[model samples]
Every structure is written in C-alpha cells, then in structure tokens.
Target: MIIRIIDGITEFTGKLCAWTLFAVGFFITFEVLMRYVFNAPTIWVDEISRVLQVWVVYLGAAYVLKHREMVTIDVLLSNPNSVWRRLAETLAIIVLFIFAGTACYFGFQLWLKATMAGHTTDTYLAPPKMITHAPVWVGSALLMLQGAAQLYRVWAEPLPSDDVMGGAH
Candidate 1:
C-alpha cells in the first residue's frame, strides 16, 4: 500500500510538471507571435520562458527516470531471467542516484548563494537568479526521490523485457 501510494504521488507530480511545460510553451509561443507580428514585445516573457524550460527539462528528466524511459546501452546485459535483469537495473539506478544527488547538492548550494547575494538579472523586468536555480534544486530533489522509487521497483517487481527496461534500447 505504501509503495502504491508513493508511485501514485510521483506519477501525479510528473503529470503536473508536464502540463506546466505545455502551458509555458504555449504562452511563450503566443508572446513571440504577438511581439513580432503585433509589435508589442513582452519584456519578461523571455525570462519566464527560460525558467520554464529549465523546470521542464529537469522535472521531465525525473519523470522519464521514474517511467524507465531514459536511454542507456543495455544490449549486452539484456537477459531473460528476472533476477539478473533486476540486479543490472539496480546497479544502474545506483549510478543514477549518485549522479542526481551530486547535481542536486551542488544545485542547492548555488541556489543558496544566489539567494544570499540578492542578485537579479539585468533586464527591464529583472528577476532573481534564485528563481532560475530554484527549479534545479526542486527538480533534482524530486528526481532523487523518483530514483529511489525506481530502485525499489527494480528489486520488487519482476524483470521486464529489455526493450521495455530502463537501461535498454
């Protein structure tokens, strides 16, 4: 029951992030059209778009990892037995956790420093650097959480087909 709840929550967060990405994309595209065609450029649209892009990429990364969709070279390790595949995937998840954890830690530190320094972008509609870095911190943390869930799933569930596996083609 606990595992199922975690999975559901993670899935919901992923979907929400995806929807946010779509909204941001649509808004940015509309802003661009309005600026070029209607000669009414938005000063803050570019900054907003850039921040949203970061959120989309990082959060989407976590979502993909949870869904076991990230690309990897597992041609040689593709095995029919459930145990071997699960072990290989667990190893892969360990490596991913290490990488994501490091990124999150450093990203959080960067966010902290940016917040302390009170730095803002140089624009007519300037925004804080923390605003940009916040996504990196949040997204990476969620990614780490999803990675933990994936690691659990690899051990709990039966090994899947290579084509449908995380480290597979």
Candidate 2:
C-alpha cells in the first residue's frame, strides 16, 4: 500500500518535471532566433533555460530510477537470478540512499539560509534563490522516499523478471 503511494507520487513528479525539457528547448530556440533574426537578445532566456534544466535533473531523478533507466555498469545486471545482480542492486540502493540523505540534509540547510535572508539570484531578473534551492531539498527527499520503496521492491519481489522500460523501441 505504502509503496504504491510512493510510486504514484514518483510518477506524478517525474512526468511533470520531465515536461520542463520542452520548455528549456523552446526557450533556447527562442533566444537563438531573437539574437539572430530579431537582433534583439533577451536576458531571461539563458537563465530560465538553465533553471529548467536543473529542475529536470533534480526533480526527475526518482523517475529515472523507477523506470530503471539510470546509468548502470550492467555487468552483473545482465544475467538475472544470480547473486551478482542482487548484490549490485543492494549496493546501488544503499549508495543512493546515502547520497539522497546527505543531499537532502545539506540542501535543506542551504535553502533555509537563503530563504531566511530573502536571497535572490545575481541575474538581471534577480529571482529568489529559494526557487532553485527549494527543489534541491524537495526533490532529494522525494528521491529518498522512492529509494526506500525501490529497496523494498528489490528484496520483496521475485527476480529474473523481464525488465523493459517505456522507450524500449
């Protein structure tokens, strides 16, 4: 029940954040066209696109994991129903748990500091630093949740199942 809830949340967050890639691409293209054709460069495009990319990475991490699309060595995972595959999966989950915990802790502290001071970006628009920093902690926490669920799944579920993702074409 709880794992399903966590998975549902992960799916929602991942898909929503994944769409930001389109926004990033559109913004960059708009900037290029404005700079070349219109000859009037916009100041916000670069920063906005960069921010969107950061979000896509930070927010979409758990989605990548949930879909089993993360970068892997694949030496052990290639052959299922083996000790090596389970070992690799356990190690990966432990590493991810530690990383997500540390990131969430530090990211929260930094975000708190920035928010308390009412900090803003150094860009021309000077958007709030909280906007970017907030997602770091938020997304890290979500990733941690999904990691726990994945860890449970690794042990609880039967192995040797065919694992194919959405874009398997």
Candidate 3:
C-alpha cells in the first residue's frame, strides 16, 4: 500500500524531471539565441538553467534507482533469477538509503542555515540560496522513499525460471 504511493510519486517525479530537462535545454537555447543573434544576453538564464540542471539530477535520482538504471555491477544482477541478484539489489538499496539519508540530513541543515541567514546569490538576480539548496533535501527524501519501495519489490517477487533478463535459461 505504502509502496504503491512511493511508486506513484516516483513515476510522477520522473515525468516532471523529464520536462525540466526540456526546460533546461530550452533556456540554454534561448540564451544562446539572445546573445549571438540579438547581441543581448539575459543575466538570469545562466543561473536558472544551472539550477534547473541540478534539480533534474537530484530529483531524477530516485526515478533512476526505481528503474534500476543507476550504475551497478550488471553481471551480478544480470541473471535476474539467482539469489545473488536479489542479494545485490538489496545491498544496493541499503547503500542508497544510507547515502540519501545522510544527504537529506546535511542538506536540510545547510538549507536551514542559508534561510536563517537570509543569504542570496551574488548575481544580479540574487535569488535566495534556499531556492537552490531546496532540491538536495527534497530529492534525497524522494530517493530514500523510493529505495524502500524497491527493497519491498526485490523481496516480494519470486525468482524467474525462464531467464527474463535476456540470458539463457
């Protein structure tokens, strides 16, 4: 039940991240056109695009993990039926959980500090630093939540017999 909610969020977040990537590309293109063609470059596009790029990475991390797309020892889980595959997935989840949790903790602290200090970027736009720092904790939390769902999935399913991962039976 809870796992379903996490999966739902992960799917939604993935789509959102995809759109964000598009936006990042669009923003960069717009900046390029403005600078090269019109001889005028906006100050905000560089920073905005950079922030969007970072957000895509941080927010998409959980989606990556949920789909088993992150870096891994493909050979270990390649069989998809061996007990070692499940064990490897579990270990990977555990490691991601730890890393995400730690990132969330420190990210939240840093975000709070930036907020309390009323810090802003040094650029002309000078957006609040909290706006940039927010993705760290938010995305880490999502990754941790999705890790739990993946952990559940790894244990609940039975091993396949017919070589579902494209290898011989």
TM-score of each: 0.84, 0.88, 0.89
Q: What's the candidate order when arranged by decreasing lDDT? A: 3, 2, 1
Model 2 lDDT per residue over 42-159, tens place: 9999888887878878889988888777876664467655677877888999999899999999999999999999999988989899888988888889999998888887778755
User: What is the lDDT of every predicted structure here?
Assistant: 0.78, 0.84, 0.86
**Which wins on lDDT, candidate 1 or candidate 2?**
2
- TM-score for model 3? 0.89
* Best candidate, lDDT: 3
The TM-score, computed over Cα atoms with residue i paired to residue i, of candidate 2 is 0.88
Work out how many backbone clashes candidate 3 has.
0
lDDT digits (tens) for residues 90-110 of candidate 3: 898898888999999999999
**Candidate scoring better on lDDT of 2 and 3:** 3
TM-score, candidate 1, is 0.84
Best by TM-score: 3
- lDDT for position 22 in model 3: 90
Residue-by-residue lDDT tens digits, candidate 1, 1-169 = 7666667767877898788878888888889798999989877777787777887788777778866677866677776455767777888888878888888999999999989999887776778989888887787788778778777777776655656645545
Q: Which of candidates 1 and 2 is the stronger one according to TM-score? A: 2
The alpha-carbon root-mean-square deviation between model 3 and the true structure, to one decimal in Å, is 3.1
